[model samples]
Target: MNLLHANDRPGEYPASYYAATATEGERFAPLKGQVTADVCIIGGGYTGLSAALHCAQAGLSVVLLEAHRVGFGASGRNGGQVGSGQRLEQDALEKLAGKDAAHAMWDMGEEAKQLVRDLAAGMGLPFHAGVAHACYSDAEVAHARRYAEKLERDYGYDRIAPLPDGLIGSAAFKGGDLDMGAGHLHPLNFALGLAKAAAKAGATIYEQSEVHQITHGPRAIVQTGTGRVSCNHVILAGNGYLAGLDQKVAARVMPINNFIVATEPLGADAAGILARNVAVADTKFVVNYWRLSDDKRLLFGGGESYGYRFPDILKTVRKPMLEVYPQLRDVKIDYAWGGTLAITRNRMPCFVRTHPNVVSASGYSGHGVAMATLAGKLLAQTVQGQASGFDVLAALPQPRFPGGAALRWPLLAAAMTWYSMRDRLGI
Candidate 1:
């Protein structure tokens, strides 16, 4: 089944809390005739929108096509945590890609955060600084502290502090590191703001324009159901929602479903759960991430499914939210939704130049909020012939799933089940 239509209707945003509170703009009409541009961007998520904005700013003609509404996918429905560094730690990156490359990647990661802060300025996005990496076990806490120290000593970055006895209020956590540099925001609003910025910069955007095939050549032709975009360059920024548009990306970047739930306004009890009002994400195979919404509702995200269809989102996520904040057991869930996000075998992003003029960036794992935004800028830079940063990301190895596209989902489900059991057994 096509994931685009499996769980949600075409051209409509999911019934998410973000969609409810987001300040949506007028929807752009879908492409119905032949169009041409300097660059054609498929998928109107953070990556595509950012790329469109940057490319337009550079005087390049840009056209962005979204299968549904802007930010309808993971960009709108995520937990909204703008995390620090690559999905893999710096030390691990050092071993995987060497010290010099790892250091370069770290600098790019820092640039990613700064780019978000710069873009969100005066955009009315609910941007906040502070994200606590909560650990369940003492050993895990120690590892976090050591990693923070390594980042300080080796990278000269010291925005992180260890919360040993838990953060300011909760006793459920053993210890964790609070990164003041990283932050959270209203993800959907952020995406919509990017769309507005891109449009204002002269990039033409079309909604409900799903691409069916890309005819690659000297000038790539991106064909939709009702129209086509012939451009010198094409960017595949669809992430998990791209599906079968490209077999190369589909093999390396597998999509998985994650669910989130929002509780009723907690009033004064919000501070009791997270004293600092910072986002908290635990160290589990299936991570439990949560933060208080602007109106004091706890937006908790956890639980995963391997299939194209999502499980009962409310029931699936509520079980884990209560596990983290049992005191909120009676708190009513106001909204619950699920989103599909791409992931690579190594959990790092997959950036590749499938063709000289065709660049595909996806598989951000769970760190898409910041990285995907940066990927767009990098994509624009690559299209402009300044590709050092994009090259670094593309050089990182992204192995395809062993079972290929047909059986990869079952294989991944089995492996994730084993890991989730380990999280429960504490082994």
Candidate 2:
């Protein structure tokens, strides 16, 4: 099944809390006739929108095509926590790509975080301050402390502090690390702002323009449902929905479904869920993350499914939310939604030049809010013929899945089931 249409309707956003609160903006017309541009972007998520914004600012004529509405996928439906560093920890990165390269990666991550902060401030979007990493086991607590110290001593990042006892009311955790530099925001609002900024910078964005194929050549042609864009360069930023667009990318980057739910406003009792307004993510293989909405409702994300169709969202998420905060057992669920996000085996974002003029980046794991935005900037830089930073990210290992896209899902499902079972058994 096509992930793009497997769980959601065409040209419509999911019934997500984010969609309900999204800022009003222009509904870009769908691409119709033959179009030409300096850059043809084939997705309207963070990576595509950020690339459009930067490329437009650089004086490039751009046309962005989206399968559905902008931010209809994980870009808008996520938990919204803008965590720090690469998806993998610093020490893990050091092992994967030497000490110097890993340090470079850390600096890149810092830049990504700052870029989001700057963009949010300019757009008047809320960028809340901290993200607490809650640990369940004592061993996990010890590691959180060690990791905090490692960041301070080796990376010069001193924004993290350890907490012996976990979050405020949730007794599910023992202790963890709180990073002041990391935080959360309204994800859909942020995405809408990016689209608006890109359009304001002179980039033409076309909604409901589902790209089916790309005719690669000196000047590549991006063919969509009712239109085609012939451009000097093409960027594939469809993420989870990019299966048929490029097999090379699909080989390395595959889609996974994640679910989230929003609870009825807790009003005066919201502080009991979390005293400070910070977001909390626990150390689980299939992680549990949550934060308070602007109006005091709990917005929690949990569970993972490796299927084309989504499981029951409210049922899937409520169980885990209760595991974290059992007090929320009787609270009403205001909204529940699911979205597909891509992930690589290494948990690193994949950056590749499919063709000399076609660049594709995806598989951010769960760290796309900041890194995906940065990937777009780097994509634009590469298109502008200055690829120093892009080169660094692209140089990292991007191993193709053993069975390719067609068979990888089943294999992954089996492996993930084992791991999730381990998480249940607390190994």
Candidate 3:
């Protein structure tokens, strides 16, 4: 897909409020020769860095290789909402994984939330908490109602509060489900903080180092352009970037491109428009998620597809934003960018050991920021011989998208088109 070269042009950062406000750090030197470690992690995004952080804390030697730079992929560019739960609701998860397993999964969601906070605190990053979902449609509100009730009754979830439409105070949105625990963050800042923590904890991270091949064994050898590392275990945290890396891992999770656009500063009117200062997302197959940056700019994200091609990010994603809040039509878009995330057909994440010495976790479907951090912890546990938690997660039934490899893209496009159509029509 030429992902490495696609968005490398000058000013690709656009005017993203994140880029403007980020605390830029010294770049890590690229891998130039052979190396070895207790564990070698591919992809230096959140998952790899988190895994490296945990493993390094456990006093295990760790080496991490990044194709570009840390936080260069979706981990850096995401809408920055630390969304709660698995991609699906509690009822659907319980129905699929049975009552006992579902309970375990529910607790894991809370763990994911806590993990982010712990990382922030441990690394001295300012992570302001306040993540909420604004239901843009009446049907979406109904789903949120059912979801909240199911969480309370079946999963013992009590943190969610439903805001009535009248109190929501925005003619733009109908109503919303307020999850005070699920907060917004500056993703790049958070990721850089973690990378620094991991490095300080003794994990060696190399940027511009791509793992091109793997020699499998009890101790697998991870070979990159400039070096090779032999480790007792390997972790694939690349997500969508794993596209051409490994066929087996790539086959299970399809890479889907999602884009986000940022608007000029909205000022104190931010709290006036939202009132509660909570992050918001509408419930739809192709969801519309938006949040106010620390600087008060509207950073909104929408648009998903199997292909990697992205339009003018500002123009492509602006229409979707305006559809929900027509008042935003006149708002000047300052930055627009896109990154790919892996999405399984079931909309549930999968963690699998593709081979005996190697394990991979991807397909968080849009719920990765939290899940990926949790998965990294699980990966550490598995590598340390405490496989119970990791095994339970691996047991989740994740079906591959229907269709042969050659037809997967077309098949997904058709299904997504229909689902989006239904969302638009409220069917």
Candidate 4:
């Protein structure tokens, strides 16, 4: 079963809360004949749209092709947290890429958040501030405090503060760190704004134009079912949905399914769950993330499936949401959906030059909201012959799955199952 069409219809966005709230723009016609451009972008999520907008602003001819609608994938369906720093903490990054390089990576991460903030502000998007990292154990709470202090002292970043025990309430959370600089928003709206900006800046966007094959050379030819794009450079930004398009990206960036559920409006009671209107992500291998929508519905995301098809979305996600907010046990679920996102072995992004003229970036490991947007800007820079930022990310190590493509899902399922068990046992 192709993951692209496994759980959703072709050319349509998932019936997600984001889709319901998102403002639909003028739909672009699918590619039906050959076209030429300086750069061809595959995928229409934050990454591709950001790249298209920046490249067009730089006066480069650009064509962006999306299999479905823009932000139809994880970009629109995610929990909408704009997290600070890399997915892996800075100390871990220091060990992975050394101090100076890690610091540089940290700066890049800050730039990523700023880009999202500035873009959303310019578009009048509903961007809010506050992300609380809830801890389940004393050990985790201690670590959160230490990490916040380390970030302030070493990186000169000081937006994060530890949450008091009383503020954690009956959610069973011990303590946590609140990052005022990081926040959440209507993810689909942000993506659509980027699409509009890209189009205004002169990037051609083609919806329902899925790329089937790419012929790499001095000039790359990207083939769709009914048309093709001949361009000097091609960017692979499809992430988990780009199944079998490039073996290099497939080998390193494996796909996984995550589910989310939105509850009925709880009115004033919603404040009891999250007193500060901040997003909360717990300390679990299978992370449980949630936040309140502008209308007071709880948008909670949790559970992971290793299969091509999603399990029952409503049932799979509701269990975790209840665990986090038992007060909502009787609340009705208004929306539930599943989305596939790519992940790397180390949970860091996979930025690679598959071919000299082709670059692919994915495997954000649940941190794509900001990083993927930043990636698009970096891709635009590389196309303009300024690759210093892109080079830093591409140099990070990405190891292939031990079982390769065919058996990767089974291996990942086994490993994740074990970790989930450990999480239950509090190990």
What are the per-residue Cα lDDT tens digits for candidate 3 across 38-124?
Answer: 888998778888999999999999998988878877788887788777887777888888878878887888899899988888767
Query: In the order shown, what is each candidate's alpha-carbon RMSD?
Result: 1.1, 1.0, 2.1, 0.9
Residue 229, model 4: Cα distance from true site in angstroms: 0.5
lDDT (C-alpha) at residue 313 in model 1 = 88
Q: Per-residue CA lDDT of candidate 2, range 134-204, in tens?
A: 88999999999999999999999999998635256888787898899999999999999999999999999
lDDT of 3: 0.79
As a TM-score, model 4 comes out at: 0.99
| Clash totals, every prediction | 0, 0, 0, 0
Stretches of candidate 2 off by over 4 Å are 164-166
lDDT of 1 at 68: 95
Among residues 3 or more apart in sequence or in different chains, the pairs in candidate 3 whose N, CA or C atoms overlap within 3 Å are none
* Clash pairs (backbone) in predicted model 2: none
Evaluate all candidate structures by whole-model CA lDDT and list the values in order.
0.91, 0.92, 0.79, 0.91
TM-score of each: 0.98, 0.99, 0.94, 0.99
Model 1 segments more than 4 A misplaced = 164-169
